[model samples]
Target chain A: MTQVIDVYDPSDPRLDDFRDLNSIDRRPDLPSGKGLVIAEGVLVVQRMLASRFEPRGFLGTDRRLGELSDDLERTEAPFYRASAEVMADVIGFHLNRGVLAAAPRPPELSISQVIEGARTIAVLEGVNDHENLGSVFRNAAGLGVDTVVFGLGCADPLYRRAVRVSMGHALLVPYAWANSWPGDIELLRDNGFRVLAMTPNPEAQTLATAMEGLARDRVAILVGAEGPGLHARTMRASDVRVRIPMARGTDSLNVATAAALAFYERARR
Target chain B: MTQVIDVYDPSDPRLDDFRDLNSIDRRPDLPSGKGLVIAEGVLVVQRMLASRFEPRGFLGTDRRLGELSDDLERTEAPFYRASAEVMADVIGFHLNRGVLAAAPRPPELSISQVIEGARTIAVLEGVNDHENLGSVFRNAAGLGVDTVVFGLGCADPLYRRAVRVSMGHALLVPYAWANSWPGDIELLRDNGFRVLAMTPNPEAQTLATAMEGLARDRVAILVGAEGPGLHARTMRASDVRVRIPMARGTDSLNVATAAALAFYERARR
Candidate 1:
């Protein structure tokens, strides 16, 4: 069982991981800086416990500690219980979610390792928004996509906002950054995965029709940034091009939502 | 053509509609207060021009004014052009979108009017988050959903953040609030619409199988708040229960994204 430590001091050194969250320069989750993986709220902290990224410690109010008591029993990480006022003073802002867990980012899994037994995967390109990146992972997990492969220009899924938006699926879902751009796509094909690139082009086959034919085969759904869509070369490399039938005069759906549709279609079959 | 007025003073009374955007009490777009509809960025501004919520005036940088020149040709509204610094001072923060359009809230549309000639519509309940509400509008517009009906406990779709997030589709698309709660769902059924309520229930039919059978009929996709989902009475009122097939150990997708998948499936057929 995890040890519960009562912490009264707002300036305790042991609470450094949870300190000064809103400080522009000192925020611990900065990728180029502290690079800590932060899991906020009781539910997300629970998810963090179940994920591969093991929490080093926790800082939260007594109510949150009680809520997380069951999940905390299985882990050895110490829970540093603090008063709400002291917690606010330590973290530089009032955190309404009430609990936070900090973890060091583990070494990334290789693309091949993540996709080893995966039947369906989402490959993203230029999805640079942190929230969008998080939502994609959430969707991928919810829609039975086994893995996510980042092609190029995607945002860090482990970013604090992305992790929170993903509801901690960013920690749970197995994902890997592609070492090669469109070149790695060929590797997917070599592994017997048929790549379907999603586009808004009217001439492309609809998602339902395209996904139906590929239901028996291993599939990789390729999505691009909202405006530009998949790069021409990336589309050319795919086995099929699929479009979601859109209403006339409306812009393309948000990147994550678009990807969700593709993932759903794939799962439907 | 709309007249372009160069404003050098940040404190000018004419720019009151665009003042102190970050102030909690003074924010002009609050539904409880001014109830004004705001569109941010050049693209959203163009959408606002095409929408029913006609802009009374615009505040923007010269570059955005240049970008919107073609769209502004038909409008009688004034374009108050200002420098970025002056805009930052007036709005109380730097707005990277570079442009904003403010419109007075038009009178609400009736449920019958919104659902007329609609083959696919989304019914929302208790989805009060502005960004999620906005994304639903964007998704509904993109995926060929003809209209939206608010069942109960929904936020104001005309809120500024929702308008911006929806790419101003909240203004362009037709929506109506329920005069009655679950009682209003009968109106949809009375109109020969098959209402499918979205749920996380494992026993429910998958979205694809459910939507495939109803492709020829008018359908209303009902979604509720993220955590609670549709009320039990609302679900009992629905024609059928439909669920997205999720991967093992994952929670539900974001409410907007789930609704989009249902919309996409309906459109695909």
Candidate 2:
């Protein structure tokens, strides 16, 4: 069982992992410097306890400590109980969630490792928005996408806001970073995955039609950022170019929403 | 046609409609107070111009003015051309979108007016988040949801953030507020809609199966707030309870994402 220690002073050195989270998260050398994955609130903290990430420490109010007691039993990490005021002072803002857990970054899984036995995957390119990145992970988890592969210019999924927005699914879902551009597309193809690149081109095949044909095949759904869609090179590398049949005059859906549609179509058994 | 008037001063009375947007929007008596709908960025501004919400005035830099020149030709609103600095001073922040449009909220459409000939509509209950409300509009417009009906506890869709997040679709799409929540659902059924309430219940019919069966009928998708889901009374009144078939262990997708899946499934033909 985890130990609960009362802490009054906001400047306690032992609570450094959970201090000035707003500033620390925005620092230029993030995920490389301290690289701590912070999970906030009762739900996310419980999810962190269940994830592969081992907690380094936890800080929260007494009520949160009680709420997290069952999940805390699985970890040896100490829970530093503090007043809500002290938490606000340390984190540089009032977090309504009341409880927070900090975990150090674990080694990332390779593309090969994450894609193993995965029948459906999402590959992202230039999806640099953190909220969208989180939503993609959340959608992937809910809609049966087995893995995610980041191609280029994608935001860090472990960013505090991303993780919180994802409701902690970023910790649960398996994802990997692609070292090569379209070259990685070949690796997925070699592994028996038919890659479908999403686009707004009206001439392209509709998502429903494409997904129906590939329902029996291992599939990879490729998505890009909202405005400037998939790079032509990446589009050319895919096995089939697909488009969501959209209403007239509207250009495209949000990147994450588009990805969710693709995932839904793939999983619509 | 829009007439450009250069104003170097940030305190011009003509620009009052665009002042301190962030603070004014949060005021308790807002929408009902100033009752102005603000549209930011070129695309959204253009959308506002095309929409029924006529632009009262425009505050923008020269670049945005030039970009909106063609669209502004139809409007008689004065374009208050200002430097980026002056624009920032007036609006209380630096808007990278460089342009802003303010329009008076027109009289809201009624349930009968908005759903006059709708084939697919989204009914939202307790969806109070502005961002999610906006995403719903964007997804609805893209996926052929003809109209939206607000049941209860939904945030104002014309709120500034909602308009921006919806890519101005909140302005473009026809939406109405239901004075009687689950009662208004009867009006939809009277108008030939088959109400489908979305739930995470494993025993509920899958969205694909439900939607496929109702493909020939008018469909109304009911979604509640993220956690509480549809109220019991609302669920009992619906024609069918449908669920997106999710991966095991995951509970739900974002509210807007769930709505989008329903819309996509309905429009999958």
Candidate 3:
């Protein structure tokens, strides 16, 4: 069972991990940084408990503690219960969610480990927007994409806003950053996965047609940044180029949305 | 030809319509609101010129003015040229978009007016989030959705954030607010549209099956708020209940993304 500590003061040293979260999350220390992974609200905290990232402690209102009590039973961490006002003073803002869980960042997973046994995966390059990254994870989870492999120029999926925007799927979904970019394409090919790059080139086959051809094979849906799209080297490295049929004069869909469409199409097969 | 008015002062009375944009957009004066529809950035400004929303004036740097000179030739509105710093001082923020165009809200189009000659439409209910609404517009534009019809509990599509998120497609794609909610659905039926309501229920026919049946017919893709889907009354009113085949243990896609998939399915035929 988890321990419950009733705390009255906002400035208590014990609450430091949960303090000024906005700044800490915005400019997270990196390169051997020991920044904590935070999950907000009852639902996400519950997910955090179930995820591989183990929480060291929790801070929440008595009501949230009650809501999370059954989940808390699975962890030995302490729940620092406090009032809404105290939480606001501690976090430097009013947190309507009323609960938070913080866990130490775990060791990064390897690309091979993430891709093992994955029949359908999403490979992302230059998707630097956090909200877009989060949405991609949420979409990947919902659409049955088995794994997410990041190439380069991607934001940290554990950023508070990414986590929040993804409805906490960033925690549940398995993902790994590539040690080497377009070179990593060889690893996927060696695993017998067809790396299909998503592009706006009209000459490219429609997503449905491409997926239909690859229905019986392992597939990787490759997506890039919003405006610049996939670098030419990465595009040439792909086994096939797929495009969502767009209306005349309209630009491509948001990268996350485009990724979702490809993921949806791949799952439909 | 459009006229050019050079202004060196940051507090020019002529710039009142574009002043303190963030605050003005946050708490929009509605109903009697003579507030203008703002188009930020050069591309959006060009779109606003082409849209029914007529700009009363323009604001931009000299560089942006040169870029937009060709598009501005069609408009009679005076281009209020100013430096980036002066533009920032007037707008209360550093808008990197570098240009803005403000147009008085045009009289709303009736449901019949927007639906005329349209083949595919999106009907939304209780989708109050501005970003979602904008994404719907952007997706609709890209996926060949012809019109958007709003049900009750929807936000203003012309809101600044919605316009920005839509990439100004909110201005290009025609949308209408229903005088009555589920009641307006009948209007669509009478217009020869096969109304297909999007639902998360596993029992609902998948989007592919439903779209296959309606390949040669006019269709309306109906969506509701994210968590609570289409109201039962509205669901009952739709001709076919359709759902994106989501993976097990997952909820629904973002309403806009769902709509895009439905639109893509429709256009694929």
- Candidate 2 stretches with Cα past 4 Å from truth are A26-31, B26-31
Per-candidate TM vs. native?
Answer: 0.95, 0.97, 0.98
Over A1-269, each residue of candidate 2 has an lDDT whose tens digit, in order, gives 89999999999899888889885565445556745899999998988888888898999999999888888889999999999999998888998999999888899899999999999999999999889999999999988988999998999898998998888999998999998998999999999999999999988999888988987999999998999999999999999999999998899999999999999888885
Worst 10 residues of 3 chain A by lDDT: A26-35
| CAPRI-style grade of the A/B interface in model 2 | high
lDDT of each residue in A1-269, candidate 3, tens digit only = 89999999998999887999886564345444645788998888988888998999899999999998899999998999999999999999999999999888888899899989999999999999988998998898888998999998899898888887777789988999888889999999999999999999999999989999999999999999999999999999999999999998798899999999998888887
Comparing to the true complex, what docking class would candidate 1 get? high
Ranking by TM-score: 3, 2, 1
Regions of candidate 1 where Cα sits further than 4 Å from its true position: A23-33, B23-32
For the candidates in turn, chain A alone yields TM-scores of 0.95, 0.97, 0.97
iRMSD, all candidates: 1.0, 0.6, 0.9
lDDT of 1 by residue, B19-127 (tens): 8775422453456465567788998988888888889999999999999999999899999999999999998999999998888778789999999998889999999
Which candidate leads in DockQ?
A: 2
Q: Candidate 1, A90: how far from true, in Å? A: 1.4
lDDT of every predicted structure (CA atoms) = 0.89, 0.91, 0.90
Candidate 3, residues B91-151: lDDT per residue as tens digits? 9999999999988887899999999999999999999999999999999999999999999
Query: Positional deviation of A195 in candidate 3, in angstroms?
Result: 0.7
lDDT of 2 by residue, B1-269 (tens): 99999999999989988889896465445556644899999999988888889998999999999999999999998999999999999999899999999887788899999998889999999999999999999999999999999998999898899999999999989999999978999999999999999999989999888987987899999999999999999999899999999998788899999999999989985
lDDT of 1 by residue, A1-269 (tens): 88999999998999988877764224534565645789999889999999999999999989999999889998888999999899999988889999999888788999899999999999999999989999998998888888999998998888888899999999988999999889999999999999999998999998888988988999999999998999999999999999988899986899999888888878876
Please give the RMSD to the true structure for each candidate, in Å: 2.3, 1.6, 1.5
